[model samples]
Target: MFRNGLEPWHLLVVLAVIILLFGSKKLPEMARGLGKSMRILKAETKAMREDDAPAADGTANSTAAEQDRPAVAPVTPATVTKADEATKTNTTA
Candidate 1:
């Protein structure tokens, strides 16, 4: 479904015009240029896909590496409870 609504008659008229304007000798060169343009666009899109792919894996490692960089640990619930009990017993109100 081309959906552009073009039909066989349109193709024949276009072919006839191309034949008259550019002639047979230049048709091969035009076709080759079209092929090269498609290849370049495909390659560029592929490279973008590859570049985006690594970030998904890299994000995990990057965050893990950050965790190792400082005195970043926070006291847990059990430790806080123990500390509170010790403080209360020692205070002896």
Candidate 2:
């Protein structure tokens, strides 16, 4: 049964302790870093939520767009062998 948890004075004391431990000069820098990290995290979560949401009658168009894209050529062992040979020649010469 915790009543009146974390009053204004409690926050002020915590802030004072933090300021004492990190110093006034470093506090702004730490706050800026925290703000930047929070912004990045917010942006990523927003993007993830958008991706999770279903497209509105656009699935067919997306499938068509995907089909229109050119397929990637597969890498072969011969191509890798050639690349290795070229690197070996350059290193030795």
Model 2 lDDT per residue over 1-93, tens place = 569897999999999999999999999998999999999999999987876666896563344457799999987675345788889999999
* Candidate 1 error regions (>4 Å): 1-7, 60-93
Clash number for model 1? 0
Candidate 1 displacement at residue 91 in angstroms:
66
Encode model 1's per-residue lDDT on 1-93: one tens digit a residue: 779789899999999999999989999999999999999999999977775564654563344456688876887776345887989989996
Error of 2 at 80 (Å): 27
On the 0 to 100 scale, the lDDT of residue 11 in model 1 is 98
What shift in Å separates residue 14 of candidate 2 from its native position after superposition?
Answer: 2.7
